[model samples]
Target: MSALVNMAAEVPENPLVPPIPELVIGLVAFFIVFGFLAKKLLPNINNVLDQRREQIEGGIEKAEALQAEAQQVLEDYRSQLADARHEAARLRQEAQEQGATLIAEMRAEGQRQREEIIAAGHAQIEADRKQAAQSLRQDVGKLATELAGKLVGESLEDHARQSRTIDRFLDELEAKAASDSTKAEAGR
Candidate 1:
């Protein structure tokens, strides 16, 4: 106890040095301030950060859902495109078949028309030939009658002689007509 009193009496008091009591008071004040900030400010900041994290996560979930929906729509559109392509191909085939059928029908119709025209022309030619033969027969008969009158003028008055003359004239006319018709057909 005497030694401790001697050490205390030898220590010098300085205005620049803080006392132990003052140092202890400053430590207590700092602890209180830091404790208050830690309990109140840090928790509020954490809550705000947590809220932001939740919002960001929810936004990401919504974005993912939207992307999935868009993918489904794209798939559906691709399927529809394929179906449309098939339909177009089917229609093209049908159109080609129809066009070919129509062409065949038109060709058949044209052939029929051509044949009908040729048949009509042949019939007209046959009728004209018959008319020409009839006219030729009349003219030839008149010429044969005149020739017979000159060849056997008085003999033709007899019935038997007239019959013979008529038979000979008809035979000659038939031969000439056949020869002329053959020549005409060969020329054609």
Candidate 2:
């Protein structure tokens, strides 16, 4: 009975639990590995993370600066465009003014030339009329003198006497014609 009780009491310990020695050795190895990783790899990982953070921040700053520069350039370009538009408008207005002035000057010159031509034409007509009237009067006077000499049966060869006779005859005829026109008007 004693031997059986001792065998039962010496039965294998619980299978769920590890031996003490192995547990102790495993804990030591785990501590050593954990310490080495914490000391050696943790700082390196932190340094890499910090470097990545700095790079991201630098990239953001650079992008912001570029955006600001782009904005400035856009503003400058807009200003230059406005100035160019203003200059173009001014030039167009000036050109229009000059064109209008030139047209006015040309119109004035044309008007002056037209007036001068009209005056010259009127003078030329007056001169021609006077010349024609003088020619007709001379021809009439010559015919009258020839007729008078035939009627009188005497040669009126004196030029001064012939002129005086023609003048007297023309004055009497004009007076008679005037009296006849007046009488006709009164009868109407």
Candidate 3:
């Protein structure tokens, strides 16, 4: 050992190599700093990292849950919209059916009114024709009685006799007209 010490002292000091004492002191300082970081700063940093990772995972889960809820809400809205559209269509169809029914009712009412008006018109015309015929018959009877009186050169003034003669003459004329119409129909 003494010989080794003497040999080391005689050796030239290399510029690159640290002296032994300085190396020892530097090594000791490095150990103290490493220990402090491992015991205190390293644990705190790891804990912070763990907290951050947990927060990120929680945030992601919350986002996924919110997205699922939003999707459900969207589905509900869409279903409601579809139902509303269906209801609207049904209402529109019902309205159209009601409109068609109303139109049909109106048309039927118009037809009924038209038939009534035509019947009323025919009845009025028949009444007017009968009145005219009765007036003309009276005039004809009066004229025939005056002519008969003139041709016979006498009054023949009795109400019952005049009525009977007029009635008999009109009846014979009606029979002739009826016979003529029947004969014409038979010919056709």
Candidate 4:
């Protein structure tokens, strides 16, 4: 046991510190790894960072361009809408004017037709009155001839004389009626 204790105490001169050769070898290995990373891996990382930055900037520029195009399209749509509205208004106004013109023409045609109808009616009434007067004259002449034949005890068969007597009687009757109407107007 004493021998074993002496060997363990002699094996390590200082327990807190490593041997010099081992420390030197470890420091050299660490420097070799750091140099390899700086030479090869660092440049690759820098290239990736630069590529990502460029992509982000391009995306922003593209988004801005798209936004501008959208704004232009919106403006064009608004302009077209305004033009359409104006055209619609103009068409409406034109339609109204045409409608008014049509109405006027129709009204004038109706008035003309009314006047023609009234004129035709007046002409028909005049013709009917003349026909009735002629018929009445014939009837009265016949009755008068019959009465005269009965009173004088002879036939009134002379056509020309009978016509002249009837015409004279009608003239005298018309004159008497006109004078009576005039006297009535004066009295009123």
Worst 10 residues of 1 by lDDT: 154-163
List ranges where model 4 is wrong by over 4 Å.
1-34
| Per-model lDDT | 0.88, 0.94, 0.95, 0.92
Query: What TM-score do all the candidates reach, one by one?
Result: 0.65, 0.65, 0.75, 0.78
TM-score of 3: 0.75
lDDT of 3 at 28: 100
Instruction: Between candidates 3 and 4, name the one with more favorable TM-score.
Output: 4
> Residue 114 lDDT in model 1?
99
Candidate 2 clash figure, as a count: 0
Worst window of 10 by summed lDDT in candidate 2: 132-141
What TM-score number comes out for model 2?
Answer: 0.65
Off by over 4 Å in 1: 1-30, 142-171, 176-188
Error of 1 at 10 (Å): 18
User: How do these models rank on lDDT, best leading?
Assistant: 3, 2, 4, 1
Candidate 1, residue 174: CA error in Å?
3.8
- What does candidate 1's lDDT look like per residue over 1-188, in tens digits? 99999999888878798999998999999999999999999999999999999999999999999999999999999999999999999999999999999999999999999999999999999999999977876676666666878876643456566556666777887899999999999999
| Tens-digit per-residue lDDT, 18-131, candidate 3 | 999999999999999999999999999999999999999999999999999999999999999999999999999999999999999999999999999999999999999999
Best by lDDT: 3
